[model samples]
Target: MSEPVKKKAVQHLLVWMPNWLGDVVFALPTLQALRKQYPEARLTVVARPPVSEILPCHPDIDCVIPIPTEIGKRALAQMRFAFSLRKYHFDLAVILPNSLRSAWLTLLSGAPRRIGYETDGRNFLLTDPLPVVKESRSIHGSDYFAGIVKPLGIETVDKTYPQLLTPDAIGKQRELLKRMGADPSRNLVIAVAPGASKPEKRWQTERFGILCQKLVKDKDAKILLFGSGGERELLDEVRRFCPGKSAFLLAGLNLQVVAGLLGNCRLLVANDSGLMNFAAMIDTPVVGIFGPGHPKTTDPPIAPERKELVTLNFECSPCRHRFFKECEPSPNKKPFCLEDITVTQVARAVDALLDRLA
Candidate 1:
């Protein structure tokens, strides 16, 4: 609780970052609060691999240690990673994730003070475990993260969106884009991330393909498809529907490359995923396509006026967000929540966001 911070000085602080990209972005404010609470303490963040690649780019963070979140038949990796953290001599560990492994890692790190939300039966592992956040439409994702640091003397968390990429890096990505055949200077670049982490969250790539071509014709925009290496098949599926000259497939590029390009783009249209949160974190205009998850609770609350969400009013529209098994799969096997959303609705949302930006 607040007693630890009030009693002794925090020399080196360990901030265990969330594994999911969206949750990682949401926790930025908590990191900011921690930095403010212990101005001179060494702040370190440990997260999973791909997202871990970009965490060091932020100015507030002093160090980032990459750790494996998956323990599929082997936890030797987690043990080695945890044993590696003990040398840092962290006086306090702020566990962002509610997983038992997260608390166990903090315990293994030999940190004297460990704090996190009391969930996943990991309360016994934490020194100051707070109450778990309640579910409500009014409570935003950022609030859940901000609540984690309140017990540590951080009264008010800064909700300002941090610039994740430097201007030099963002500017350098233009050459990379030009080499890839996209001219952001000549054409208004609209980056599209058609893939989502969860199957229930992604819109049909065929609609995404059609929407890209329409944007090229109607708005004279150049489409840049962003996705990880694993999403090459999905990226290819969307590019197959796009015009040959205008749309470019950018699968398998570095996350920083995508972030830099997102920093320079006119706007980003993505399904409800980490890339959507990434684009918004770097201050890009985002048009997020919502399916089963309602934007009210799932989306970040920062700069609501600058962002737009498009979803239907179906009875099962805002079903249980995580791994939604409630809805019957469509005949084509696509989840009904995402399959029902038409391309026209998405285009209208994109148009409205662009118009507002203009």
Candidate 2:
């Protein structure tokens, strides 16, 4: 009788990364775990354009395939991406994001072993489908992603926060600061990210302006306001309230540059957004303002002592609803859950962080 042939080990692994910036940060631990399990394998990451930009410098990833951002052409984009991925001949495809679209792409890639959570009705597509537990949804985002890899013999240990930076990026940060009239040598630099993807997740910009003024006056800190170009108008509104040389708007900068700038800061005060997670990843002290989102599910995996989460515990506070249309409007037309959190409360939290560092 002829001897049976042995199965070959996984040599090329393809990872379908999460879509949102914060979600992408949360998946870093899983990416690290995958790298540990298959150290010899060529790891490729498939991500959206914004998420792809932040991941190209990641140590574990060999390459990043960025999908086009145009919503109207995403179907064609995915087809093109799948065709490109087929050339790599991936042995295993890990779908980190629980979406039907992700599963379809994995299926289309013709990977031999497809592993992912059995949510979104895509279980039939996966060779190894891990059952989704309702309780798991409430866990921290980093932990949530890490759990998906446990069935593949990769142990999920304490969350690993990935650091992304280069010497060139750091140098650019210093130049950017100087151009913005910020003297890092003269004063402590504090970064403030007042924008959140969701309007309800954002604390009132007026409150942020007040907090900036207070930080400038009391903490003797230079405010480095960070946000996307889309948020330039919102940052301008905050600038209107905070009129001084102390606050410098650093909008529209490269994401890596932003990460490097945040790394240089003494502290980062941000709404529950991607920048907040980025600060934590870079080991910068963070003061996160929470409102509609619960810190339990999305909190950065930083030491509690180093991070201060300021939030109100309203019954409907952590609705986790993505849009205003999904929620019932408050009487004042503003999210009361966020409106209830006072500037004094957030300032006090900021003071606590500063005092701890001091």
Candidate 3:
């Protein structure tokens, strides 16, 4: 049996946020529910520089302490960071990541009550360890994360995604679009994120280009291609297919700027990735092209109607995230599931979503 907790009694709550941007988004509802349950408690989140930099300004979060992102010295940095958390005297700590290091950090923080899912051989470190799904992504990631706080009495997580965009963010993105020669205020703006963490997860670049070209010609839309600095080559490749068109390469911008720009867009078309999740969270309709991995794992509660997923659901469909690493490509050297998804399929999805919004 779990220990009883007075909902409003918890103070100085510490949350160890997940590393992945998508994971951070999925984990937010749990925190949101906690805020309602413990309104008087001061909530603080610990995240890396990337995740910390992009988190929206939320009333629930009183403070955000960024730990170091130096990969070379990660263990040592976390150990030091954990030691530093002792002074805050957090009344309770919620560990979001399933990694052992996350659990170890909570243990070292000396937080009297620590709660997290039991996995990665770190169960012994938590004061309350919850049962983990056999495969973390076997179900919705948000559900898995929301369940982590059950021990603390946050039982029912609402079927809603957090509102991630602020007025300032939306304004900044609009301004950026203007400077980039994009008339966002007057024209249809569609965001295209062509890069995924795994190459296996991405749809064909040529197909993305075709979709961009179609959207630009049919809807008279401005295309903003979003990606990190490293993905410049990928976006560049996507542009080659949309030559002499409205598609503008927006590679290398920070997540905040990207989110801001995305908010100005009428819709986003992308493969299954954090950016797709980000766009959906911000209330921008998305047409997600997925294969190899199932959307069931990370789909938000109320996002099904707002976003459309294009998957062939092949016989060998949903090899899941694990299969991304060991993917066996077709003779064309593309994932069979994704390669079969035509430009028309994705475009229709985009049109259906946009039409509904219209």
Candidate 4:
């Protein structure tokens, strides 16, 4: 029997998702809503290039348009990108990222109904310019992105970020685990992400090393360090301090393979990096060590029992959005924000997770 055709209320819908992994994760709820509303209509996502790789198998989106680099100047890039968007004849465009660039894209897409925050300079381009509530800034990024879609008649539902693990990735992860002598049956497998986008967001390396040692000694867990190319040096520093049969350093793996490996791990202990949010999207329990970034904005939003399992903190945390720029630590060369977070405290959080699992 043939499946009945979905009567299209609107044919095309476009969403401009953020470039960073964590930001993209927050945009998932909006994509899920679009899927529910459109059902069969083509949904295109205008995502930054690095993020484009994940959208091919994304269950929600039909196409991924890479955000082209402006290359020359701001005006030239905007005009070029705007002209480039003329290709997609969209009926309605939902701009998820609140950047003027994103709003401009939606406008240039010439979608009859473009909806986004009114703050960006491209407000004139949007047909439905929704005001960003001052209070909404404090809300979780997941909730913040969800706000833009409400005007599109998109219903709210819990949308954990989506990660597709391929067969090759699974095979590679299994091989790596086996070579590292990771007992597939008994010992707990934990992935530690020791780096963040900005230096301030990073958990103390010594503290992370201590936490790994404690987990291995106490729970007989196997620790694996995961990070991107940029984080290789920091990961190496972590490896130097954490020594024994139970720990392995696995950095610079392809993102998909890392996701696959994380899928099999018992839990992930990470700083406020994209890796932490990636783990949450894959439904892996994550103990996120948040410092310079707001936990409410960056931490996982799945149920407390399952995702965002643990978060380490200090009194004067979240000093800056970027390194020491927006928010800074104290003067006189004394950094108290992440300094107050001790190794013992993180170990306690890990112990609690072990207790819950047992």
lDDT of each candidate versus the true structure: 0.82, 0.81, 0.81, 0.72
Clashing pairs in 4: 319-327, 320-327
What are the clashing pairs of model 3? none
Model 2, position 48, has a per-residue lDDT of 87
Candidate 4: worst-modelled 10 consecutive residues by lDDT: 1-10
Query: Residue 228 in model 3: shift from native, Å?
Result: 1.8
Question: Considering every candidate listed, which one attains the maximal TM-score?
Answer: 1
**Model 4 residue 345 lDDT?**
67
Listed in order, each prediction's TM-score against the native is 0.93, 0.91, 0.91, 0.84
**Overall local distance difference test of candidate 4:** 0.72
lDDT tens digits, residue span 23-107, model 2: 9988988898888888888899988866688888888899988776664447877777677678889988889999988999888
Q: lDDT (0-100) at residue 356 of candidate 1? A: 88
Error of 1 at 255 (Å): 2.0
lDDT of 4 at 324: 48
lDDT of 4 by residue, 27-82 (tens): 88778887887887889888775566666778888888776654434776767776
TM-score (C-alpha, index-matched) for candidate 1: 0.93
Model 3 global lDDT (CA atoms, 0 to 1): 0.81
lDDT of 1 by residue, 174-250 (tens): 88878877778877889999998876678987889999989988988888889988998898888877766787878
